[model samples]
Target: MSIVRNIGAEYQPGKGTAFTVWAPKATQVELSLKSNPQTRVPLQREAFGYWTGLSEEAVPGTRYMYHLDGERDRPDPASRFQPEGVHGPSAVVDHTSFGWTDATWQGLPLDQLIIYELHVGTFSAAGTFEGVIEHLPELQDLGITAIEIMPIAQFPGSRNWGYDGVFPFAAQNSYGGPEGLKKLVNACHGHGISVVLDVVYNHMGPEGNYLNEYGHYFTHRYNTPWGDALNFDDAHCDHVRNFFIQNTLTWLRDFHIDALRLDAVHAIYDTGAKHFLQELREHVGQLEEQEGRPFLLIAESDQSDVRLINPINKGGYGLHAQWFDDYHHVIHTLVTGEMEGYFEDYGKPDQLQKALEHTFVYNGLYSEHRKKTLGTDATANPARQFVVCAQNHDQVGNRMLGERLTELVPFEMLKTVAGMILLSPYVPMLFMGEEYGEQNPFLYFVSHTDTDLVEAVRKGRKEEFAYFAAKGEAPDPQSEETFERSKLRRSYTSDPQQQKLREFYKALIQLRKTHPALAHPDKPHLRVKLDSEKLVLHLTHTGQEPHLYCLFNISNQPQKTQLHAAAGPWKPLLHSADTAWGGPGADIPEMLQQRATVSLPPASVLILELFA
Candidate 1:
């Protein structure tokens, strides 16, 4: 059956509103309004375990809840606006009321997407969706084409990473509800920036999750890190699948979201003939055809399975792109020289070269961390199919103190890391405050009302960071101070060094957009060579005219390397070690000949354009 779009309270202009909810477990369900609790309307139970009713008095501003079997009152499973909190009544939202200014915005192609991921609360001082809109101009000026926002679904409190969202449809009350989110999306499109929302579909948050009371939303057949897994393959799973599919459509159709970044797809266990991702992709494709615009699905998976991004006709899930952490792992380990937990599987200089040429370094190889063969060869996939980054929420926030790369690495190494990520043949993403050197930590935090649940979260965080126990005790996840500390200081303009770093990032972004070799992801014509002894990486992009030669010196000492370029004069394009960029000095000559020996400065990167 086709998916239903109007699952919750859908308001009609002249003809009141219609409410539909899935409640298979309840024999009787009544709609109770929050404004007047005495007024109750009984809904008729429809086939396939759904309740439907129409209320003339239930206006757009009316807040309501579903009373099941005259026993319990719970918020709608598909709430659009949770004004009070996750535990409060859901408000009726008039999606048509908001006037959007982006009618001409179609969307950006995968090749042209330079994503900047940010958390709405920490991104701005106001800590609301409108607050994020305030910085759209600054982001556009930085050459960002899209912003991948962390999950904003209705979680418990105002301060959170947003992964514990319980209401799939409702926008968080603290971050400014549904209307606030719409305004931000509308503003983003107006600025020619596509919005990619991070969504959690594997499991609901433990605190205010009421889906189990409505129907068989979770199953014991499989287990996830959050206990019972979503019922994607179990019995009575069609309705549950429809619930999520409708949520996807609501965002794309109603909210005008350009894409969705599915958080942690590895935790989603579905063994059906048609996997949940495939079904969701099919629905999204149908919407794309109807809307005449592009809609993308980017998955975050640790499996490194090519099937996730492979075409459905080729026996795969057919997702557009995925977060490729192998590249980040190799780069982080090489720069930090710290091998703990999953970092044990990385750190070889050859692996960095492999990740640049090929997508994955552990393709069908036994992983020292997993103790088993993991991943498939991803060389067949296009480079744009992988979204790589130097640092992200998981890479930074997962640390004991949530220290960013700026705090972990030196100033020169920071420039080198930016060069490696932006110049590589893939879609590049930058975490918030990464453009400049924001020193504040992006720690894990939560604000659950249940004392026991809060304690459990604190204990889980401590155990998660057991590898870094010697770094001192982790900050309390339930503390408001932790969330406050994660906020960006926005000191790039005031701080001279940070301003220089920001300029360097802008220059790299411009190069990525304008340079022939960096503009396109021609993996077949890209060649990579690594010297583990000298800690130097040489990359040649020969796909386009006037081939480009790149060098990265990751060592602390300068290394002399031979430039194996074509028999022509090569002009220096961008040198990270140039004195103009706060580096010591440029050691390479102004003009380079073929097979010329040049000194590469310590912790520096150089890009040269070959001229025939």
Candidate 2:
């Protein structure tokens, strides 16, 4: 943690700003204030490639850059705000200047998190952090405890999915800078909504990348899908690791971020005694102990490893939770009946049941997709350790057409799928506009300044989906229209059909909060039974206070099953086939008798409260 000391520009109001940079390779480093070559402030070169200097001329709002070896100038790698974009000089931002009102806002527990993931560029009409503030009340009303915002780091251009961000510490200039982010976080805390930021630590973007000139930031020993992995275990990697650790602290301490969703943890290749992930977790734990507030770390890991969410005492990385893709794959294939690519292992009723009973369907089992046995036992993990979603940015945007669940499946089936996710024991996350059934496609859009890189991205998009016969031509990634097309239409919720879907989602979320069986995170209490031939799923809950019986007809045809229960009658809590949810009508009785035959309509979900 001491490695972060004297790094980046620290500005004071009455005093001046102190500039420090880690240019270990450079013989000499100079500070250029206001991007003016005339005012070159000489920095005292210290040991370990660090240079420090104090300048009265450099103040808050002043744009500056580091002149390495008295030659080429590069933006500060630890810049707090990049007001002029990623390629331009970094601005000196005083984080203490923001009058935040969330001093007493202790974050919610991981189990209570109903995460709503939204992109700052596409969530609101203004497409800024301030624009997202206006919609806080709606999310608060929707039972969302945490708002997991997509990456807002400084990217090459205005429009991007944010994966191409190079400046990890700075906020995107087009979507408002550091001050804008603070304002949004303060506003969210005021609305009782905790903020979770998505951060990419695996690799930096190709364009506007200047870390290589400073130190050995990347390692060629291992490569990621995006680029070369960060050098976490290599030589002189102490400061390199501290660079990201300080970034996390800046969000948690300065910006009052409640949690971090680590982007693609599987890509962060590190083979060391103490992994970078574990170090990050320990640092966060120390902060939590000092602040007496719960700060969580969530990982987006595709490896299906339980060690990510396991406790440190249990020999694991100790992250709070991870994104569970198996839940999505099973539900997607079961509802839509699409068995392509990774969806091949899923489509069966037994698979869905397995996913329900256990967190991972392929826990130590052979995966047909990977052509090898994938995952380990995660049955011991609590449900809250997993964040499940039917539709997300990767699932929807990675497609050739970028079609959402609304565009892929029928309206009734969409409600059924929503019921499954919200009622599940695991934490639920709703992608932007998923609650209202917004029809806009979340296309992958980028605005790179480099012509060759832009053309390469366009070419790669087509080549990646060339084998899929069902998918048509993909939208041009270089086009501005593609970015605009992904923006959410808030007015869509006003439509009758869309409003009905939103109400259904709201009801399920509310029931999840109220019902013990739905809210409980214990897996042993939940029992899942599947009829593969009829595509019927019966989930019985007996562990908690409120016993529940959930039945779903995943097929497109009606199915009947005989109910065998102990004694008394069961009350109807929610029926997906009810007229209120834009369904045909109720198929099950209001109060069921023992050994009574119950019928379930096509693409319907029924949740009953046991009163025995």
Candidate 3:
């Protein structure tokens, strides 16, 4: 197996450190220590726009910057730790120094992942990497197999969403830096939970961005909503690709991250024979083989393109999975009755049924919102290849008021939605406070220092929400109050209603893991049907003995639905409207026969297990 070499300052034990950087735009590159600016070491320019040098003075914990052409100074683009925010000098870190106890961890399989997404800054009172470790026991007990953290790369300031990260290699200084992140991952592995880091390679943020001064990292050939797209297929693109590919390997090989959630892959434009994602997967596969552990590459894609997850041999970019937003749009619109933006295409009971059955409601269908056809058929993909969620960061935080599902619909409906998501065949992910229903709005917040850039962000947010029905001006994105308000109110978990909801989620997850039919996603044996008149959904899993039948009543009024199961006796497994879940009552019969008429309560869900 070939060892992967990092491009930043690599600490050599007993010796000094070897520093390498790609500075194609500079005529000369010099390393200057922050502790003593007078000390400078000139680096030798190498082939392919790279500069290399050995500096005995530059050791671990030393802060340094590159002096470009004797004119201006800038931080290392691949700095492992930005100790003093994004604008400060970069600090050298020894990757082997941290003591890790997860040598025996084999990592969780893709199908077994029950992901809980959280923002590091707002996940706890401390709002740091170490702060997240305190909640691992609770998350483990809640049956979460993995935690998908939002991006932690150093950004303009502490409060902004990680998508605005400018330094792809450095860990955010405000969130305890590189050491803090390693500790969090170590603790998670000890608790039998995997870690998935969300990384942004689509575009660099406006503030504190210095990549352009180094090399051709961005190209104007294609445009993304965020900013100039990464130069994946433009001039001098090989080095740019290597820069990101090395970044991807560094996270897995050095940091021991189990998986990476590629942010907004739909925005990645590459026309080369071998796509960037494919090359990334190839490199990850090699590393995975060397480490003898599973390393998954999941994408957050808006386009339901099967090519993203298709096998490489079949002329497709091989990926483990992609986020299924069609399910969220269908369920959110169906429950809230909101019909604006992308929600305009959903809001029907059949759409929810189609999403569950085919994995995409807009597969090869014309999108009225886009005024063109969008998405391809994803029905042939494995069920586990699609990650479904009722509410995620983008769904909640991007809203005009950042209102959670708890704030939009009735309390009883919350149970129904949880049941639908948890019991589905696809992998399920829960947002930070959604297990018990967090009430605090996850408002968009930023801490950029540039006044003009801050104003542009404020203006952009207002126009993004113009089509929505939400009234009132959006809270200031640059305000500290907005960041504080987005923090999860952990105290809410103590409330009786919240406690019951938490218990319901725990039970559903337990069942999903233990039940024969639910344990494995046997899509071939799955069936779904919708009764538009009664506003009921019927789902059946007949892959294993003791089949499962799930019924969801989305309307406010109670609805009667016929059982669609083989000849057998059906027993009540879980009912959302039961008294145990703090619902009105359990109106469904205790024992259900095949083809029997079942009465479902308003806005409730019922799961039945059949015995032959």
Candidate 4:
């Protein structure tokens, strides 16, 4: 494998631009510029199958492509901007052009994060990065410190969930492309909000993928659910790995992204002496040390192994955090009483208690859903290393009708569930429109240009949801109606129930930020007790500042639970069933003595702050 100082199109003011690409299989390569098919500049072959050349006429904003073997024209493999579309030519973008004002900005710590995940295409009426910028103030007002955006890489067409991205470095064309993304990041920093992008490095989208044509980017030896696995451990894999490492650095350095949430890292099959994830983590660490800025990497792994966040010296990958799906599953199953598919093993009340005290309930235990022993112990890791959410893109978009928790459970239960998520020991995340209880479903939608691929996707979606006997044919993935129906309705908050839900979420987040016991991210300091028969859960946090106690009754029956206070009085902080929150039930008493038995309303949560 050959290592180059820099790849892609690097531009200078009067010096024009330099172009470099790796195409070992091709005998020759030429650079085509500015919509002229006849204009071609031959590049000299360098060591290790690399083609390099400098064009005095090519400058920033100049559209170009690489002609392989003087035959077909293809976009740059590391293109920074694909304004026309994925199948169109690449445009040279000036990285230094955007005037960023966040010079002294330092990112927030992992433990202090309150993430709100969103898909740009469906987040607002504009369906662009500019549209998302308008809502950052509201999110910050809601006590969210970080905004986790779904994948934005260039895909086949206009609309997608973004897992089908083919261009690893290019911004999505329909979402205002590169300049728009830079503006969004700049605006976020102005409001003291950090941007965490969800990135997919597991596999490329099948449609309009040209990586294999330029070099051996994909390996046939390994397979993933999407397609062939990326060649991370094969011959000439050094540059392949460098391609991804450089892409990540481009986002952090050029676009000023605070963090990256790696998507489905368990699907990245690599068996080399030096693992790819470790190498990527070291690269990011070096950047952080060099620039003296915070850059976090959160992996989305299903293996349930704590090694993903463990220290590198301790034989681990050293990533900052991982997505905790088990926490969501436990809450979803226990709150909704659904026992099907992967949720078959999680409806028991004890499972939720385990998730509250520890990160995962399936750690080093038998999984009835998988029919095998799954996961390793996670008790040794801190609660900040896990990002827990009650609803996300996968948990809602993959369902038969794309129904949310608001549709499945009662309005009172929604507030109770929100309390459970926001007040937990782990970092909390909320799905788009979840805070306001928006009624529109987040269905899976795509806009692929290929007719054959579109039909195949529709057929596969129907077969995948066939297990749900009550549901019939799913909405067509290619239809415009599917994408339109998924857009978030900002006007829904006018309703009384939705306004109450929004206020309830805001209060919970505020409590999580202010309360001394709830602010900490230590699972060891937390205690959980679950009464399965009465469906009541009691959680306590023993701390020096102000002790905390929370009781939740998931069932629809009012029950009384004893509060075990230490020395002084306990003040009621929040009650989900109170009349102010659109509930018929009355509020809990203002004060409670030690060992007082309090009656909790049906399907409600009571949070108390113990005072000395």
Top lDDT prediction, candidate number? 1
Question: In model 1, where do residues sit more than 4 Å from their true spots?
Answer: 1-5
Candidate 4 per-residue lDDT over residues 554-591, each given as its tens digit: 88788888875555488888889887887776657789
Kindly give the stretch of ten consecutive residues in candidate 3 with the minimal lDDT sum.
1-10
Separately for all candidates shown, the number of backbone clashes (residues 3 or more apart, or on different chains) is 0, 1, 0, 0
Instruction: Tally clashing residue pairs in candidate 3.
Output: 0
Write the residue-wise lDDT of candidate 3 on 311-408 in tens digits: 99987789999999999998898889999777898887778777877888889899998888999988888899999899999999988789999999
Q: How close is candidate 3 to the true structure, as a TM-score?
A: 0.98
lDDT of 3: 0.88
Q: Candidates 2 and 4: which is better by lDDT?
A: 4
Per-residue lDDT of 16 in model 4? 86
Ranked by lDDT, the better of candidates 1 and 4 is: 1
TM-score of each: 0.98, 0.97, 0.98, 0.98
Candidate 1: clashing pairs of residues: none
Clashing pairs in 4: none
Question: Is candidate 3 or 4 superior in lDDT?
Answer: 3
At residue 48, what lDDT does model 4 achieve? 75
Error of 1 at 285 (Å): 0.6
